[model samples]
Target: MSTPSADESVELEWDDIQSGALHERPSPYVGRYVLIRIDDREAGRELVRRLLPAIEAGHPTADPARDAWITVAFTYQGLRALGVPSDSLDSFAPEFRAGMAARAAELGDVGDSDPGNWEQPLGTPAVHIALAALSPDSVRLAKVMERAQQAYGQLPGVEVIWRQDCYQLETGRTSFGFRDGIGQPAVEGTGRNTNPHEAPIKAGEFLLGYPDETGALPPMPSPDVLGRNGTYLVFRKLHTRVAAYRQYLYDQASSRAEERLLAAKTVGRWPSGAPLSLSSDQDDPELGADPDRNNRFSYHDDLDGFKCPAGAHARRANPRGALDHENSVNVRLHRMIRRSTSYGPSLPEGVREDDGADRGIVFVCVGAHLKRQFEFVKTQWLNDGIFIGAPQEADPLVGRSDTPGVFTIPRRPVRRRLRNLPPFVVTRGGEYFFVPGLRALRWLSELDS
Candidate 1:
């Protein structure tokens, strides 16, 4: 395995890092996810050896003609399945080694969302590898996936345990009716800081072996060659109850216009992705469609939560400048490279009844620290409201609690609190993984050599 030099440690190795680790998923896309389990160490290494070329060695969308990218990741058990040394294996982050199921309590995966109820093969050692291919067209996506299949199709020792195909909804919004991929943070070297309100977060916040927001190198997994350019990954299968969500909003609202306004305030953004900070009273389709101005607003002026509630899912997930007065809360440290793809068909407009069909998103989060970034957002922000000064409130849209929940919307005359907020999203299953860079893939390929 090739090891980067000291100077290279701080440099952004675009070619070495997996594109999916740093870049957002392309919109208007079709994709596939396949989970594998290795019964033989040699077979696992051989699969990696054969699949390396199929995996992109550079930026996901660097080439103008290339519209698809394939990426691979491994659970701790996967590394062990490949015969990675115990010392090196133990060096990974504690949370990762524990796996997602073990940390269910911390992630608020209780009641129906518990790990005991998670989908089969997930949260278990049966999941050794995760491979995915995403492309804007079905033909291109299938072509890439075909190459991946050839890598492990004939390997008797490698078993395909599960697979899911995802696509962009016609509405281009999440199942809950809000723009899905708005307001992603920019990484320092990646040139993602297009929004004037956002500064590129330090690279180390997302990639290993680089100086982070704290101006220090993030702690890398042991064995420099294996850890450098790698990042922790979290993928959860969240099942959204679209019908219930709509019914609740319909029940709370007296009219269709009020219903739309209620939904926008809940997500801090309009159905078209327009942020409430810019258009508080109404949905601005033009502003929501503009990439330049949609995500340009801030919470500094709306600290009182009149425009956008402090407890809105988006606001709580990313406070931006809203928490500046606290001084102790640094939003950058908790930021991660998050992307998701929708599975199942979008619930048709004006329908509020259960279709009895499974539909939701497969959320993929990439970052250097699982505990601080992904888990922190899940527990401290999404599942708890202490950070936003609403201790009793969780994220109104996605928050999961046993008792009846309350969502506060600060407004003129009187503050409105929506009570009995149900868990609109349920955890189907998930796992923690380490997505290694191109060089690290080579390292895994030769593990049995």
Candidate 2:
């Protein structure tokens, strides 16, 4: 990968890119995700044509407080079902064509990654399109859903096979009791909030047709108009074992304080979202609340991983400049824009044991290159430990662990090791879809033949 000059400025066509793909639009206090399949080619095309106007496009401003937004994405099969040309279809990344299920092993989902175990509409071949409706409140989201239902109802060939409703918890914590969606990368041109030290990455890194960190434009699908401004999306439904997670903390720690500390070490942050690197001795709720400071620290100050363990979940996910000192890997090349939301009810405070409740996060990853950005992080950074200098460890928070796993925490005198860790998160379902530019949506709708 060639490194692009940092001073180069590239203008982004906001109207062409999908809105939800870039902007940190208002958090959907309530959201509805729907997966559908196309049964009739002509009907599907007609549906796209009619739905094109409702699809939100990227813009300089977004006010979720008063307006709801609906974003549409299509699977490889969905494009074919809509009559996209063969040459254009063949131009997409091979992984997109193979689908998420075919690359399950690379994502660390093998023994339990089979489609048979996935939720309805996901494992089936009929899952061709995904629709997400987000609003600031439940009533607004319902209205959006109603409009979507009415539109889809007009087309008999389009079927809504699966649906998942997600919402922000009152406590602002995921099922695992950790503050969620705190760490997000700043896209070079999105104009979203960014910390002082956080450098804006190239627009091409997250959107097609722009120069990536490598200084080269990523491979886009055929027909410049159809592929430009488009990006690949990875949607996953992860189930968290809240009871088991709490139980493990209790079993490992001698006291409640120790338990909290252990949890923080595992996640690389306190429950309040404070990084251990800044407040290593205790949880600092104030610092965590301050976005400017919470995400501003890097591993360069604490290279030995003493402040924040090298194998910690957050560290493993984004090493920042930790691996850059050796000039081995540039952290910017593998960054991904995260849009994850909690799906189930928060476990009641003081609940120490398993309640048998189904709860987790609906993780959505958006990027221009699925293989280099998303897949690389999943396979190399999250699953393996050699890169971080810990060979026998996995990400303590979300790594696949059928057998006992290990988490090493660097400390003075002797390093602390947490052993016998089980898989706290499981992949219930997932899919890869192409979020087209607004113009591309129209192009897809008009395509014949």
- How does each model score on TM-score? 0.96, 0.95
lDDT of each: 0.86, 0.82
Query: lDDT score, residue 141, model 2?
Result: 84
Compare the candidates by lDDT and give the number of the best one.
1
lDDT of 2 by residue, 1-449 (tens): 12222342577898787777775645547888998889998888787877777777756454546677788899998998898889999999998998988888778775454555777767456889899877788888888777777778868888888989898888877788778677676667665544445667888888899998898999999899989999999998988878788889899989999999989999999989999989998999999989877887778878899989888888889997688688888888898888788888888877877777778899998998899888999889988898988778889867755556899988889988999898888888888999999999888888778
Error of 2 at 149 (Å): 1.8
Model 1 has an lDDT value of: 0.86
Residue 20, model 1: Cα distance from true site in angstroms: 2.4
Which stretches of candidate 2 lie above 4 Å from their native place? 1-8, 25-28, 60-66
TM-score of 1: 0.96
TM-score of 2: 0.95
